[model samples]
Target: MLETLVKNSRTSVDAGVYEIRGAARGGRSIKWKEGRAALITEVKLASPSAGWIREGADPEEIAASMVRGGADALSVLTQPLLFHGSPEYFARVRRSVDVPMIMKDIIVDEAQVAAAEALGADYMLLIQSVFDGGYAHNMDEFIEMGHNRGVRTLLEVHTAAEFERAQNTEADLIGINNRNLDTLEIDLGTTEEILAGRNTRSRVISESGIKSAADIARLKKAGAAGFLVGSGIMGGRDIEGTVREMISAC
Candidate 1:
């Protein structure tokens, strides 16, 4: 995946187009509102399976719209291959918006974390499936490396076992990714399953498979601190208005 991402990124750059990697730096602090689920809107251009979302969609315009629509933070898809996004887009969006920006990429190395921090990212997403131990670090040395650099980590988990491992890590936020990376199949019940029998103190963020405001409400009732919405907003014709409705529903 990393190799494919680099190749695609180079190609896009060669074509004089920027990607959305490391795009969340230099934004306001991430706030996990008490008793309310915040909306983390995504600024996406295209996807491997879904193709282009609003062809020629301007990153700055989308960011501004999300903020105006009441998004608490902005998550820009930074993966170049699968998502057709770039690090440059992330930087531009961060500069254009006041909301906290999260670098949404398939982070596999510490260098990527450093790059995100250098780019002014407020948060870094670490998918459990990609991590060796399904956390930022090994259980014995569970340190929040990214957090120390002023970048919070959102540990993505899909199963109960992964959720258990997340509990051991010192992640500030826990993201329940509804879509299985291996199959790309979405299961809305994943959030409920993960939060079922856990004593997690970390803030919860429901990710993927969120198609409506009712879904947000359901997750909020399940104790999710935020909603990581990507496709729903990106796939919509009116991205800004859709985000606003989702926030109002929450």
Candidate 2:
């Protein structure tokens, strides 16, 4: 799955101006303010594990609803093969809302970093396992590229080892993803288990398996600084209300 995602990411990269610019919304740190945990919602159309999530809904509408519900930020999936996401979707959502936005993709190549900058993403998700797999450039190189483009990085890790390595990087946010990308399995406790030893939780954002306010309360008790929810909000009957309820947990 990782190999396929990397190949898909590489094949999709296109040349661009790669212009250097300052942070559009004050450095991706805008998601966390007043010392309160944030609700980072997502515009996920589908996933390899769940398949066709809101297969026909407009990305702009989904993002607008999330903003209406007071989402602290938005995550736009950019992978196209299995996830059914595209950079165009990110661009559409980028134009629709003002909340801090993240370009969520299996980024292994530097061109993806340029794409994130061109799309005006405040932050780009960098998975540690991708570097651990030796698929492309390491996290440090991508993080530097993103910094040069004035795009922050959300370093996502799925294991204790990866989390440890993530702690040593200059990533702006540390994301603990509960879902196992390769096996398509999810365990919400993954966040708690990984963050148990950390002293500061201010920059920790828990991802995956985040469905309800109860899940939010549980993770909050475990010291997660933000929640990156996708399928839960997208799959709900009411996207706006769902996001509101989740934010209410904080």
Candidate 3:
């Protein structure tokens, strides 16, 4: 499934034209709120690990609930096969939410950056592991493409070594995904383990396995400027309350 997504993304559109078409006008900048850890609540339908997160859930409604709960930013999963996400869902969330949004997907090509911008996303995710595994795409190129199209970039890294690689890029925002792609397992320690004693100007975001206020505090102490939490809120019965509690925890 991963290979197929990468293959299709590589040839899905003409990069040059898509870059031009991706140009857009406005989006809210991600500024961490005072006295609270920046919260980037996500609109995810499913995942390869959890599966069927919230079947038939409405992305726009979820986004609105998140905003009401004081989310600083939003992330919309755009991967279709494994995550059951779509660009249309992203567009809806963008229209409904008045916050910075990151188009979270397995971005393997520059065209995906174009797609994110065309859909009005404020930022696009770039996974270093994808390129490290010998993919033909370049992260720097995609970063430049997003900047040209009026979008920012969030480079994701899962390991300390990957964090080192991320430092090589000009990406200003960095995310540490606690969920391991290979094992599909999550450990809160992953974020701290990767960021321990590290100093950099980039904003560090901890993703996944954020269940309670304590968890948020732990990550904050570990040096995360913000968090990208999804399933905890999306899979819960009370999304608004969950978002509020998570924000308060931060």
Candidate 4:
């Protein structure tokens, strides 16, 4: 999956699918409202594991619903092939919502960073494995690129080693993703297991497999300061109410 995702990213970069904007408006801070219940709702359509998770849903509507449910920020999947995502979706949702957004792509190149800036995104997702596995530029370099382009970096780590390395960077947020990219599996305890006995000053956002307020509360006890929920809200029968319930839990 990583190989194919990287290939697709490189293809997009080579074809100049992402544009670099000259000037960008400032991005909203992830720490909009304090408390353990900070939420970053996502606008995702599909994924390799969950095919067609929310097909035919408008990005603008999803984003608005997330905000109405008290989302501090938003995340939009922009990978074209495996995730069935597009930069266009990011742009549409970005224009419709006032909250901060993170462009959730595999991000194998600096070009993607520029693209995020062009779309008015406040943050861009940077995979620790993608950089650690020699698939792209150094994580520091990518973080710097994001800074230079007027967007913050959200360093995503799945393992203990990656989490350890993430704290060393200047990224604005460290996402402990429950979904392992290599295995395509989901574990709600990934946040708890990874954060056990670890004191981190960096902002840690638990990603994936978050379903209800209980899930948020458990992750909060695990030392997660924030939550990035996708399918949990997008797949729900009532998006706004689902987000509201989960947001209130933490």
Candidate 5:
């Protein structure tokens, strides 16, 4: 499924670039203020591990709820085949909320970066491991493409080696994903294990498996500047109330 998504995305590179060039650009810039762990709530519809999360969910409604709940930013999944998301979801949510929106997808081509800009995304994700899979081959060029379009890149890494490689890039943010892609297992300790005894000035965002306010506080103590919680909030009955609790914990 991942391979097919990468193949299809690469084939539309030129078209994606052309579309973004013709589209207007302007969105809220993220400001990670001190004294709180910035929250990046996600508008995800489904995943391989969790299957359909919030089936038939409204992206705009969920985004607004997140914003009202005090989310610092939003991450909207755009991987259609597996995640059941589309660029239109980002656009829909953009119109509903003013917070920074992240184009959360397994980006494999520059065209997707352009699509993100055209869709009004304030930030886009670039996974370091995908380079090994023949996607995002030119890491520097990929990062530059987003930067040139005024879209900040969030370099996501799952291992220590990937983290090391991500550190060399000029990414606006660094995300440490606790969920192992292969096993689909999440361990919050992964965030601590990687950040232990490290001195990183760059903003660090802990991703995956964050369940409660204590989880946020633990990561904050481990040097994480923010938290990206998706299923924990989206799968819940009350998104706004859950988000508020998470924010207050931060």
Candidate 6:
């Protein structure tokens, strides 16, 4: 599955020129202000469930639109098998926008971390559910490796147990995913539960289940420092307008 995904991702045009250095390894540190919720706009071509987000959507155009709409950061889906995204897409988005770019993928090894940095990702995501079941990978080693490469890590968790497991690691940014990866079922309340028990030192982000400005406002009030919104904006006929509205609500 991973090989197929990588192959599909390579077909996209090469986007930009940038390099990722690890946070602890002398690279540019992500300047995350206190209580700032970084808006992560996802760049996806398609997904397992939705198939296609926009027909022939220009990555650069979409990225520019996202920045204009008030995104603090960008999360580009590079997994080819599930999201029809590629590293090339991220490179392009990086060139098109000045905000920090996070590579969103189901990372299973250190090599993927190296690849994310090589592709100019300022951040990388590691889903706790993927490692919790002993899926041939260790989160600790991955986080260490990412930090060594100067890439910040976003530990994604779906439940309390996973959240606890992630807290034990050096991960600083925590993503509370409302959608269960196994079932893809969404529940916004998951964000509340996770936030209520989160470690004070860890920065919190609300991922998925966000659609409108009201949703953003509610999550912000709940102490979410940032939001990872994709489907909502992608599904909208007016991406720029929808993004602006979300920012305004927040």
For candidate 3, write residues 112-140 as lDDT tens digits: 77788788888888877778877656778
- The TM-score values for the models, in the order shown, are 0.85, 0.92, 0.91, 0.95, 0.92, 0.86
- Per-residue CA lDDT of model 5 for 1-250, tens digit only, reads 4466565556545445224434645456778777877999999989878889999989999998999999999999887766788777877787777788899888876668778878878899888778866766898888888888888888888887788778888998999999986677999999999998887757889999998888998998898999999999988999999999999877
User: Which lDDT tens digits does candidate 4 get at residues 62-105?
Assistant: 88888998888899988877788888888878768778889899
Off by over 4 Å in 5: 1-24
Cα misplacement distance, residue 87 of candidate 4 (Å): 1.5
Model 6 superposed RMSD (Cα): 4.8
**What stretches of model 1 exceed 4 Å from their correct place?**
1-27, 133-143
Candidate No. with top TM-score = 4
Summarize candidate 1's per-residue lDDT along 126-159 as a digit string, tens digits. 7665555443344222225576677877888898
- The per-model lDDT (C-alpha) reads 0.75, 0.85, 0.82, 0.86, 0.83, 0.75
lDDT string, candidate 6, 160-182, tens digits: 88877777889968899988777
Return whichever of 1 and 3 wins on lDDT. Answer: 3
Provide the lDDT at 7 for model 2.
Answer: 75
lDDT of 1 at 162: 85
Clashing pairs in 3: none
Positional deviation of residue 178's Cα in model 3 after best superposition, in angstroms:
0.8
Over 4 Å off, model 2 = 14-28
| Weakest 10 consecutive residues of candidate 1 by summed lDDT | 134-143
